[model samples]
Target: MSDDEVLLSHDDGRGVRTLTLNRPHRKNALDDALWRALRDALAAAGEDREVRALVITGAGGAFCSGADISGGPRAEHPTYRMRMLSDVALTLHELPVPTVAKVTGVAVGAGWNLALGCDLVVATPSARFSQIFTRRGLSLDLGGSWLLPRLVGLQQAKRLALLAETLDAEQARTLNLVTWVVPESEVDAFTDGVCDRLVGGPPVALAQSKALLNEGVDRTLRDALANEARAQGVNFATRDATEAFAAFAQRRDPHFTGTWAVPPSLTDMNGSARSPGPGHEERLRQAD
Candidate 1:
């Protein structure tokens, strides 16, 4: 990949698109170029009608070390840098398709947040995640504040963010941050297995399910229930759902067809929380 392009290598087969982060030297850090490339890749995958599932992984042993502090043009204004980073995080959160993060090694700072952005994370036993912002006189960037709290609750998220503690893959799994932790040697195979299941499943059903879950997090219980009912009503009208019920009646596998559009309301849903904001990493480190 060119320097301007985030090292994005993709393989599309079996209805799955696997996008690998290429900057192994910097541990796949999200530099400006990398972030742009990632956005482009995600957009492409989302638009591809043939792509049923998407997987994001690092090229080398490490999943991602976080923001590429050593890379990118040195911004004269700190505010600009913060804004750019926040935009990247927002892009990850807003992806239309279900995205999976495959972690094999250390994921720190922005890297940890990137993994958090994905719909699910599949990690190797040796994988480690750290919020090192405090140690570096910074705070969590790249949606760490938003994503972490949702995954682990406010108290645990605060402990990780405030302490800058390193969590092993096993620990992360126990905390419900990662879905699965397997032996390092089996990481690739495990990720492939997950992709296989996702790709073979009903695309419309899966997309709606993801949309509902993401939206539900920010909604009141009644609103969420109503949203769920609305989604279910729409899903029941889809050909995929029809086929699913038919297959169940016949005792056979159901084949899904066509790409479905995620509802605009689901996509536009927003939540209220303390603006853990972008420059927390710097502030925390300074206090230390």
Candidate 2:
């Protein structure tokens, strides 16, 4: 398949972008080309200021089935090929914008880990998941070793990895692998609503909050608090914080543009805009 055919991207015009793994005949399996395409698409979304939320799903009623091992052998070294998967995994995990995985059918092996890498995962009742590397005579790849243990505790992670247990939607949710399990009919609408809420949120603040949670797990309390303080300072420098305060006072929803607010120097000690001299008003125009 062509690169674009292997991975489809659509923007909803309301700041939500959806990426579909398009190789459904192979259960959306990632061939080497698809891995590259997925990585590039995720990187593009991260760089796009207009994309406030992202949803990763699969076409033809199935989520990914992991790597396309059925393909003919290649000349590349195993480590080099593994690097491609690593790049895709890290790019998805480090995205500043919120991400959701909409799972309809099976998500196994690296496919399951891909879903887990998202900030949130929504699955239909019939969806299935497995850490199937052992069944395939392989070990966990695509951040599964790190994500699974943290998500489900070491004991549960070991059970899943060693046994290659297939989990239904409810079972996965109980283990904290899936965030929500909606009915098959409602999963699309439910995921859309969730993404809509994320899209409407303050982008700068949300990004900071996501970063803090991702990093806080590995930091001391004192370090985490210090990092939070720094994040709050950054948030306050954005127009969204001021808009949020104003909206709260007015009892209305805040509109966030993620623009930089007036700098401290451009604002007086009283927190009002300061015109240092003639024509300074234009200089104080909000920075993008």
Candidate 3:
């Protein structure tokens, strides 16, 4: 496939962008070029105000098998190569839009971490996951070390990483790793439904809530409450907030436009509406 085909992007005209990893031959493994492509796609999605939701999935039944070790020798230094992965990971994690990972077959090594980076994960009954790093004679990369512990607790994280144990979809759900275990036939429809709800929600409020939850983990209760106050203050200044209150009173569904209704003078002490924004890895010898 040509470079453009490494990662395929689709916009459904409903504010949902689906990014499919298109390399079926290698289970959509990340080679340098594919990594770059994924990173760029995610970056573009983040910047596009029209994109309210993002979905990541793999073509050909498998999510990904981590890095493409079979790819030929690399001219770049290992650190430099790792920087590419780091960029992709950070971009995905920090993306303002909600993201979903639709997993079918195996998501191992960095591939699993990639899915974990998303806000939600939907996997089929037959889907499988593994840290797969130790088995490859390496340690976790692509934010696995950080994501796993927070997701499944430190002990479970260590077990997965140290043993490189593969877990089926149900088992992963039990560990709180997979958000939803769906049947293959219905998975697509189900995921589309989820995205629709997300897309229909108040965008500014959802973004604010996502940021609050993400930051709440590391913050003190007092600090979290403070942040929540600020977030709600901003939310109330959006047209969406008005629509929601009106909808509630009218007993109808609210149509959120995500438009900022705050006057330029109110959004900032200096009378500027601008607000400060809130703030991956490589293959083995290639490593994931």
Candidate 4:
């Protein structure tokens, strides 16, 4: 499919790739074309060595209002829509690099699950999330049943899904569903800032860390520790690690070359801290 068919726009600069859903009139609703475009964009970004971070956002105002209900796409294969949506969600989860979802407005049903697929979510104060499937006599799609439970816990997930209630940005933040809630006008800036930080960090370290964390969710502590140690050994041999240590000794910032083999220790490693890298505390403090 050609780029124009996807209603997706991509921009890359300074190791960051921003993909915007361009179907504004439909509130960037999910459709087969849109999903295909999203998958392609993500794959493109992942394959590009220059791209260190990826940010997904919707054009115009709304993030996404769930699947396109205007007939064409959904009507084409009603029963298969569930599987298609789940495939899209799984594709997002498989992204190799760090991904951030920037929500400026409404994110309902499948749209909410799409944002949850990203590693981090930053929403504007005007943003709202809802699981409206039950209200429409439909079940959750796009891996919502699996993803939501792990995110906000089974009970809270059930309450939202069953009630089909709208959750504001602040409420979502309190539930730990979003990383930050900024003014609507600041959404782009905030997302860009996050991308900048990710791009500046050690690439191999970040990727390994993300993988380990994702894997740890289902692994035993002993297995996780062994996996982490292996990851550390792999990363220890990378040029990025050499630079990291050198920078530490020089009391200067590290400039990574992106050719390093990811360390196994970096994967499966755990710490009490929620965020990664130095100055993470400062970022949280600023958020507070």
Give the clash count for each candidate: 12, 0, 7, 9
Give stretches of model 2 more than 4 Å off.
Answer: 263-288
The local distance difference test score of each candidate is 0.78, 0.90, 0.88, 0.80
Model 1: residues >4 Å from true position, as ranges? 1-12, 71-75, 259-288
Rank ordering of all candidates by lDDT, starting from the highest: 2, 3, 4, 1
> Candidate 4: where is the Cα deviation over 4 Å?
5-13, 72-80, 261-288
Question: Candidate 4, overall lDDT?
Answer: 0.80
Candidate 3 runs further than 4 Å off: 72-75, 263-288
Reference-based TM-score of each model: 0.83, 0.90, 0.89, 0.84
Q: Which is better, 2 or 3, measured by TM-score?
A: 2
Q: Candidate 3 — worst ten consecutive residues by lDDT sum?
A: 279-288
> Residue 68's C-alpha lDDT in candidate 4?
81
> Judged by lDDT, which candidate is best?
2
**RMSD of each candidate?**
14.1, 4.5, 10.5, 10.1
Q: Give the alpha carbon lDDT tens digit for every residue of 27-102 in model 1.
A: 8877777777777777777777777778888877988888777644574877877887776667667666678899
Number of the top-ranking candidate, with TM-score as the measure: 2
